[model samples]
Target: MVGERSKQAFERAKRVLVGGVNSPVRAFRAVGGTPYFADRGEGPYLYDIDGHRYIDYLMSWGPLIWGHAHPDIVRAIAETAARGTSFGVPTELETEMAEEIVELVPSVEKVRMVSSGTEATMSAIRLARAATGRTAIVKCIGCYHGHADSFLVKAGSGVAALGLPDSPGVPQSVAERTLTVPYNDADAMEKLFADRGDEIAAVILEPVAGNMGCVLPLPGYLEAVREITRRYGSLLIFDEVITGFRVGLGGAQARFGVLPDLTTFGKVIGAGLPVGAYGGRKDLMALVAPEGPVYQAGTLSGNPLAMAAGLTSLRMLKRAATEGAYDRLESYGRRLVEAFCQTASHCGLPATGHAIGGMFGLFFHSGPIVDFETAKACDQALYADFFHEMLAEGVAFAPAQLESGFMSMVHGEAEIEKTIEAMERAIPRIAARRR
Candidate 1:
């Protein structure tokens, strides 16, 4: 229930905020309802303004891996804020954060911090262009690499959620430089590269394809992309902004044994704070300015509070990994998706799901959902009904079917049971509506 208070809040926000929300998806446009305003979150539960508590599977869109308001991250942010939030000068905290990332991620030899995923990706493309001396970049259709102009041509997530084909402001010439191929289709990528290999500077993709739901790479798909990019003399850039630390300790690169020339990261690395990073081969990173020619600078790139929170979160994850926390997370996701699919089937509604580490997707369609084309074929109306009913059952999934559901370390067995119980009840009722 988005209570009267939240409704009023939205009404008030509409006077000041664009579409009554800072982000388009948050407005609940895709789900066809007013959004509930979150008051606070604790562990895996979010409390809304109406005093409703829901088990949060969205987890702030995949950043709250340890769940909300974890004491460690909060304390880190508070302590670093006391020291000062930003100085416009580099801090040792930033260096330590960089070292932690370089140590953990297989593809990154050196890193440059930025304030947002968009910054990391935009800067990465610039560096790729400068290093390869080519203007064209290749990206997968429906694989979102942030909101950088070049990436919006065939983006997913909010762009798909809002039903926008492509944004208006990006120049056609800029769009032309960004070649798009269907995800999980190695031959399409190969054909494109074969046709215009010399014009391509880089091939960028979400290694796990989180944007168009939690789509996995086809067997040998990532390796094929890597081989093609290498053969074509184009850089391979993995946008791990959503999957970075969430999928595994070393990200998709370490998990899949495929390394890219450059990697971009966000979400879990910042521990619910605003931060992003791009790093890879030392020679390529050397091209970023102050050390080389490609110019990219941000005042809050390495803000102490973000660095502290991120470092604390990473250290926590690293320790937890040693204790099989990630294994448990993967298990939780698997169990939940299995339960969701089973329940949907029992209710005589077709459904499919995939769970990889802490990320999962539930689709109202029979699936071997390999790419965006298949992903878009899911039942949007059924999902929207299921979302609202699940809300009524006191569980929170992503507002739209296109988004991925995240599991946190704090989503214990009890929470998992609670969610399944909610789904068992919600699914049949929603399915009945569809019938």
Candidate 2:
């Protein structure tokens, strides 16, 4: 529990790095504490610079599905790196990765890699605009599609954690083009299309929203979106950055049986490396440069290291799929959710928990959370208390209530049991703070 080294490191970091962190969420601003500096991760555990270890539920914000530095991924990266880091030229690994992605994901026909999720989404939006010859894009209020100017309005994750309605630097003109709607509300979406169907280029969203604390799509909502978008001549974009391989071999689209026109992906695809991709119908993806008019390019788009790591991860996932990896994830996820509910009830605190596959959320509220408003209504102060208490008990969770906690294949029964025990012990202490 001693974070002396981390505290000292933070003091040094703030003198150089912005907010003493590369990412805003790592600042621990919402959780009211200094961030712990992780030294390394092995299996499901993270060891910090202060010589303290915790059972990690963050999983690098949902990318390390196979757990930290899986030998195969490590070896792949190492071997690829030994050849050359960046060629800025074509490589067979890129083709191999593209083939693997197309084979695994039901919706993707052709994919182009990018360095980050932000780039993938930004490019996808551009493609949508070009293909439909329209400008405005519809985004769910709490769904985050990265930091692109058009997507900053009412975005979730770090923005929600900081309680910012919209980022400051985005121009009014850019924000105006993006329409925001509530998650899981079919009528509102229908009305949006009816009102501006002609001008709307695409409707983009997280098919299974993870940014606003792992909210799942309501029954029939995704289907409604698919049908509505198709009817309106607008493309549907699934920002599967979190859910792609984490949900299943085919992702949320396959899990829910709704195929989107375009899908933006990152996270699990990279196996903890920096990579992102967007792909869909062959005709639509063929529009990207060198093939057609729409333009998108990256210097490190398909870097050998990233491709090797991604390929290794995807291959492992494909193999695991046959052996019921998702089934085990569902079983473990349900156990964790149920455990949280039991612990919350015992502590006399109302709680709502939900999970799909390896992604889950623990809402500090009494009832189901369906949209941004209700999701926000969950007590942040209480969550902060729970987060710190759980951290103290050697369990690491996302520091913000709006971020979902991830479980990995490495989080076995022993780890799950330990996590639940930690939650049970931490809940009383967190509850005591409220009184």
Among these predicted structures, which one has the highest lDDT? 1
lDDT of 2 by residue, 1-435 (tens): 538899999999999999999999999998889999999999899999988889999999999998998888999999989999999899999999899889988989999999999999999999999999999999998998899999999999999998777888999999899998999999999998999999999999899999999899999999999999999999999999999989888999999999999999998889899999999999999999989999888888988988899899889888888999888987888888898888888888989878999999998988689888889999888999889988888999999999898989878999999988998888988878677
For residues 282-399, write the lDDT of model 1, one tens digit per residue: 9999999999999999989987888998899999999999999989999999998899999999989989989898999999999988999999999988899889999998999999
TM-score of each: 0.99, 0.99
The list of candidate 2 runs beyond 4 A from truth reads none
lDDT of each: 0.93, 0.91
lDDT of the structure predicted as candidate 1: 0.93
The C-alpha RMSD of each candidate to the native structure, in angstroms, is 0.7, 0.9
Clashes of each: 0, 0
